[model samples]
Target: MNENLRCADEARTASVVELAQELIRRPSRGGIDPYGPVLGVLEEWLDARELPHRRLRDAAGAPVGLLVEVPGGRPGPWWTLDACLDTAPYGDETAWTFPPACGDVADGRLRGRGAADSKLAAAMFCHIAADLAPRAHELAGGLAVLLDVDEHTGGFGGARAYLADPHAARPAGVMIGYPGIDEVVVGGRGLWRATITVHAPSGHSGSRSTTVGAVTRGAHLVRLLDAADLPGGDDGSGFPLPPKLTVTAFHGGQGFSATPDRVDIHVDIRTTPGFDAHAAETLVREAVTALDTALPAPLPTAVTPVAAWPPFRLAEDAQPAAALLGAAAKAGLTVRAKTAGPSNIGNLLAGEGIPATAGFGVPYEGLHGIDERAHLAELPQVYAVYQRAVLELLGR
Candidate 1:
């Protein structure tokens, strides 16, 4: 390696690790901790570097995240690099070998909650933006770093705010910095999430009278849902995976004294391009209708759709995907493109007709679980790959 490039990588290593540790120590668990302190640390870093950045907020004026952009001298399409600063709640603090916010760099791993799931990527992208700022005039297109604080909460307020901004240029493509070095996530199965309310006659359990309870009806419905068939694998839709359904949550009943009148079931269906959200909803509704007919509830079961996102799969030659994949090869890394089983922000962007490459970074362990940490041994290589990809996209 050239001396200058080696020095740059070393500097990036120190900066990224230091910043990631600082942010991790602040504990910005999504919807749990206030975003101010964590976002403040990042903003301070940007400010120190004199990078142009701004805070994104939701409709209620809550800070959603931060956006940093380095515009080029010439006009070209904008590209985005995204990573979430918010983290999943630390499941059991006592179960952790170290503090959830330990921020330790022992055994070649950065130990912490958001370190893997992605505060480290957030730190890396910030430095990438800073690196581009000096040579912004030499590039063709611009680079944007989106540090999302509302990601793990499922609100996606940060991405929404940025896309909704009238003045903000629509990104040509987006690369979400989710961790996992083996594959670059090019697409994901979209989801149709809904709540089903099962109704039954409420009565005192002691009174008997052969009254059917909501619990009984709900249990029956669960079985029916489980038996319901989804589209089998590879329906020739160009997507490799098939549709899936899961009854995620069920709530009903109180003390044994009384039979509950209503039960709510949360259903999550993973959709593919061939069987989209509408198809999933239809299948679910059919199951509910069958339940209503056989069980004969006091009122027909209610199926209310809460959220839906259409599935997307980027072609191998697709923009951003091609650029990133090529860059990885150029970096002498054999990273393959993958379609994740679970939906991500990439699905959301696909809804707006934007393509994205998600989940390419350092290897991780215990993501969203106990002892979450990102292995730092591959940090330099991962960093170099992304840097090369961004530069290639920017036509540098």
Candidate 2:
């Protein structure tokens, strides 16, 4: 980049960090109304800049997504940069060394819940749009910054909202601002998150028949699922990561005294393209049925589908990936394509045939856990990467 652009980016870093901090202060947990107050920050920023953007709403009139466009200096193909307003829940607050929502800057890190997970990138995208707005005609096509609200729950609803928009051109490609700044995420494992509700008869804790109660049955099932060697080979064997399945949540027991009448277990299965969610669901049902019958334990069980996203893979030679890689190279940053564990909105975008949908963002720590943070000093470079990516993708 030229010294002028460098100076401009330097001037914007503080505001970017400030914006990220402000966003972190808002708690947009997973739900239908995720963007309620959180999106106001973006709206105010755009309003202050006199930039044109639109607010997307669900049927209930809640803000679900924000779309802002910066026309290029010249005509090139359209591209989008993706980020989300929602952050994973700050689980077990007592476990954090710092308050989860305070958004304090410490030891060159921004200590907050959503900082690393996405807020940092969201703030940077806004700055990128601002920077590019002045020289719009110098580039080809345009830039679309999509700050979505419904990513943490699963990237489905927010994606649907954006794709269904008639006014905006479906982006030729997408760049997801996610973690793994060192790696360009070319693909990720398929994922299925669902609820398994066990319908076991309530029995007293004082029972001497040695039969396990509902909670016990749930535990046993969890253990069974964990220990069982289920089938499904890895899709991309060359990639370092492989398929995985885990019981994310186990909720049961009404009280300490009485035997729990029901148990709800949330299962998350991550796979390479080889594993089909329907097939996985069948396996889970078969396992539960076999255990319920052979173990003489639970009376009944039911599986309810929650969410399923197929694995996403961008071709190695895709233009967006090439642009991103070139941008990283130009920025004097070393980056290679790899698969990340967490699934993002790319699954939906890639499924929709955006050939180059991929995840890229600033590096951070403690994602979805206590003391979650984003590297404060890395904000500028993140901007540079995105700027380079946008230029490469949209340059005339």
Clashes of 1: 0
Model 2 TM-score on a 0 to 1 scale? 0.85
TM-score each candidate. Answer: 0.98, 0.85
Among the numbered candidates, top lDDT falls to 1
Query: What lDDT score goes with residue 210 in model 1?
Result: 89
Candidate 1 local lDDT, 1-396, one digit each (tens): 699988978888998999999999999999999999999999899999999899999999999989998998887899999999999999989999999998889899999999998999999999889888999999987998998999999989999999997867789999999999889999999999999999999999989478678999999999999999887978888898988999999999988889999999999999998899889989989999898888897699999999999899898798899988888888888899999999999999999999999989999999999999999988988888888889988987
Best by TM-score: 1
Task: Provide the overall lDDT of each model, using Cα atoms, as 2-decimal numbers.
Answer: 0.92, 0.79
CA error at residue 100 for candidate 1, angstroms: 0.4
Steric collisions counted per model: 0, 13
Tell me how candidate 1 scores on lDDT. Answer: 0.92
lDDT of 2 by residue, 38-141 (tens): 88988999999977788876666767789898877665678988888888887898988988889889999988988887888888888888888888878889
